[model samples]
Target chain A: MRSINAADITEAVANLFKQANYNLGADVLAALKKARKTEESPAGRDALDAILENTRIPAKENIPLCQDCGTAVVFLEVGQAVLIVKGDVSKAVNDGVQQAYKEGYLRKSMVIHPFSTRTNTGDNTPAVIHTTIVPGNKVKITVLPKGGGAENMAKLGMLLPVAGRQGVIDFVVKAVEQAWSNPCPPVIVGVGIGGTAEKAMEMAKHALIRKVGQPSPDKENAALEKDILHKVNNLGIGPMGYGGRITAFAVHVETFPAHITALPVAVNLQCHSARHRETVI
Target chain B: MIKGIILPLTEKDIKSLKTGDNVLLSGTLYVARDAAHRKMIDALDRGEPLPFDIKGQTIYYMGPSPAPPGKVIGAAGPTTSVRMDAYTPKLLAKGLKGMIGKGVRSPEVKDAVKKYKAVYFAAVGGAGALISKTIIKSKVVAYPDLGPEAVLRLEVKDFPATVINDIFGGDLYIEGKKKYSLAQ
Candidate 1:
């Protein structure tokens, strides 16, 4: 068995938080550049320019890309052959997040409660961590700082098996139309098809980490993504929802087999900031 | 090319602004979002005086990152505006004239803008670092317990924003989309 020190994981996660907040990822940057070119409205084009310029300023000056530094969402793929030594895995992740938010000067956006009290957790700890045991020895960690504006707009629905592909497209298009400029336009639409309700939602979020405009390996899913993309852009949401031809930069669909009776789908919308960073240790 | 106006401005100065007009703001503004708005509205309900006067002042719906040493603020950009929509009309009733944030507002907010002769401005969402450059100073003014959601009194200069909803009910998002939308 390959033994990985828990301290190493903690250090890696901490560094990931700091780096991700300071640097805008290449995939997201490329998508923004493409959106700038395709956006039709003058106001939409101007918004895109500001977003690009913001990324540059943050990287050059070592500041965060957005004031809502977002909740630290850690996705971990731990290989079955590896054993974590020295400490508790979950606590280690939280420790790293705490250190990063404090040291990196990012905002602490997490609250202790949702409806009541609404107390702040000062250090931005207790990250939303998801871990999966996979085949390899290396552990892959991806940090996605999900802002509230986009997170609040996420949707999930369970359709009867008979609803088919058109149902999926309709649900996604409707969700984007309803959200309009609320999630901040020129958004990325992540669609999760099949699976159970919760799994579908997770899949939709996971799909967002894929490179922009990259299609699913499955031919059917790729076609679905393309159709949904066309429908969403046609909604006239445009950049910042100010109206334009480029409402969505890309629509990424990920799918899995489900029970014969279920056709669950989930849509997780991400604003243009789309802050995500990954590391393999 | 549209001319940009200097900041530390008044309602009278911004009233002439229209949707899609580019404006460069210079001078001081405050930063407040959901938590701060709730508290401020509560105080108003209690008939207690606000920590900062609402007259001729611009409040940005932002909760900025802690500043690095030698910097005024970190990634100080606008947050989504709709979250504070419920509290905005009340604030506007008190002579709150200008607001800076992202996203669209409710019809009530648009109506309030026209009723109160206030202006709703849109800053580039996600352009925190670029926006922070314009803020010359920042300090917590109220609701410090809310952490990053605290109300901050900021001094800004030459900040860039667009008039999204003007006093005449001109909605930039609606109008802009209508102009560019293709019939499906």
Candidate 2:
């Protein structure tokens, strides 16, 4: 068995958390530049210009991209043959989160006793972690910092099995329309389909890690992404809701096998400042 | 060219603005987001005086990042306005003239804007880094314990924003969507 030190994982997670918030993914940046040129509305073009410029300032200044640094969401893929030595994996990840948020000047957004006490956790810790065991021996860690404004706009719909394709499209479009400018337009739409409710939601969020404007590899899923992209843009929520032609940067769909009776779906939107980072060990 | 906006927006300015106009707002304003808004509303319930005078003042709904060395403020951008919906009508009734943030407002907020003759402006939400350059000065005025959510007095120069809601009952969100949406 390959033994990997947990401290190294913690250090990598700490660095990744700070880095993800400080920089925009190259794919997201490239798409924003293209949107500026292609956006039909002069108003939309103006918004894109600001967003593109926003992408640059943080790198130069060494500042977090947005004020809302977001909750640390870590996805772990551990190889079955590998052993994590020296410490517990989950605890190490949380430690990394605390170190990064504290040292990097990222915001402490989590509240303790979620409903009643509502006290700040002081350090953004207890990262939302999801792990899976894979066939290989390497461990893969990805950090996706989800901002509240966009996250609050997330939705899940358990449609009737009979509802099928059109129902999925309509629900996704309706969610985007209802969300309007709330999630920050020129947003990325992530759609998860054909799983249990929670599983659908999880898949939908994971779908966001796909490169911006890239279609799903699966043929049917790709077509769905394309159709939803067309419909959502037609909503004309535009850039920042000021009435421009380009509303969403992309629509991404991810699916899982589901019970024969169920057709569950979830929609998660990310703002134009799409930030993510990944590392493999 | 960026149109200039003078702060402590007046009724005349409120009436003159329209949806979709991009203006570079300059002058003094205050900042507050969810936590501060909540506290202010609670203070109101207790019949307590507000932390600052409300009449004719524009409030920017934002909670900026921690400033790095040699910087006055960090990536400061607008937060969602809808979260502040519950406390807004009370502030509006007290003569809050303008608001700067991103995204849609509730019908209740729209009605309050119309009823109170106030205006809602939107700064590009994710463009915090670009937006911070305009913030020339910042200082906390109240609710220090709320950290970034504390009420701040800020002076900005050539700060970019668009009027999303105007006193004339124009909502850029509805009108904009309808204009480009194919189904309409």
Candidate 3:
């Protein structure tokens, strides 16, 4: 068995968090440039310009792209044949996040006893970690720092099985419309269809980790993604809700098989700052 | 070119502003977010004076990261304003004149703006790093233990924002959407 040190995982997690916070993904940056070219509303274009400039300032200043560094969401794909030596995986991951947030000057946004005390957790841990075992020996770690503004706008619909395609589209469009400027348009819409309710929500968030504007490889999901994107933009929430033609940078739909009785749909929106990074070891 | 407005906005300043007007603000603003707002309201509930005079002052609903060396402030941007909806009217009642934040406000906030003759401006969300450049100075004024959520006294110059709600009952979010929404 290939044994990997847990300390290395911790280091990778720390680096990923810092990198994700300090830099905007290249795909997201490219998409914003393209949106600026086509955005008809002057306000929308101006908003895009500010957003594009925001992308640059972080890299130069070594500051986070936004004040809300977000909750550290770590996705781990561990190879079944590999062994993690020297320490516990969860603690290692959390240590990395703690180190990065403290040393990198990233905001520690996580809170504990959320309902009662609403207390700040100080170091932005423990990270929301999801782990899966894969066939290969390499471990893949992806950090998606989810900001609260967009995350609070997530919605789920338990549609009737007969609701089908149009129903799914309508639900998503309405969710985005209701969200309006809150999620920080032009946003990236992540749609999860089928599966159980929680699974659908998880899939919706996972869909956001995809490259900006990249369509699903599945033919039907790809078409559905396009349709949802068109309808959401039609809502005219526009860039930062200034009202324009380009509301969403992209719509990503991820699906899983579900029980015959249920047609679950979940929508998770990502702000234009869309920050995520991945590393394989 | 965008119009530049000085802070400690007077009645004349509030009256002149309209929804969708893009303007650059140069002046001092007190920065506060969720925790600070709560503390302010609690202090008022106890009949104690606020940390600072609220008269004609603009508050920025912002959260900031720790400043790196050679920087006065780190990436500072507007947080979601609606989260502070519960405490806004109280502060408005106490003479708060303006607010800078992102996202839509509740109807109560709109009514409070009209009643109080205050204005609401939206700085581009997620543009924190760019926004930080305008923050020439920052100092924590109260609730220091709240970390980044602490209330800060800030001096800003040429801070870019768009009027989202104005004293004349004009709402840019509503008006802008109506103008561009295809279904309508």
Top-down TM-score ranking? 3, 2, 1
lDDT preference between candidates 2 and 3, better one: 3
What is the DockQ for all candidates, taken in turn? 0.76, 0.74, 0.78
Candidate 2 lDDT, A1-281, residue by residue in tens = 89999998999999998999889888998888888888888878888888877877786796778888898899999999899999999999999999988788787788878778677788887799999999989999999889998999999999998999999999999999888888887899999998799999999899888899888899999999999998888888888887777889999999999899899999999988788899999
What tens-digit string does per-residue lDDT give for candidate 1 at B1-184? 5546655556667678888888888777888898899999999999899889888788999988888888888888788899999999999999898899988899999999999998899888888899989888888988777878888888777788888999888998888777876665
lDDT tens per residue, model 2, B1-184: 4568889787778888998888988999899997899999899899999999989999999998888889989889999999898889999998898999888888999999999999999999888888899999999999988877889999999999999999888988888877777872
- Kindly state the number of residue pairs that clash in model 3: 0
The C-alpha TM-scores of every prediction are 0.97, 0.97, 0.99
Q: Of the pair 2 and 3, which is ahead by DockQ?
A: 3
lDDT for residue A120 in candidate 1, whole number 0-100:
88
Predicted structure 1: clash tally: 4
Task: Report chain B TM per candidate.
Answer: 0.95, 0.97, 0.98
Candidate 2 chain A worst ten-residue window by lDDT: A111-120
Question: In lDDT terms, how accurate is model 2?
Answer: 0.89
| Residue B10, candidate 2: alpha-carbon lDDT | 70
Which segments of candidate 3 are over 4 A away from where they belong? none
Largest lDDT belongs to which candidate? 3
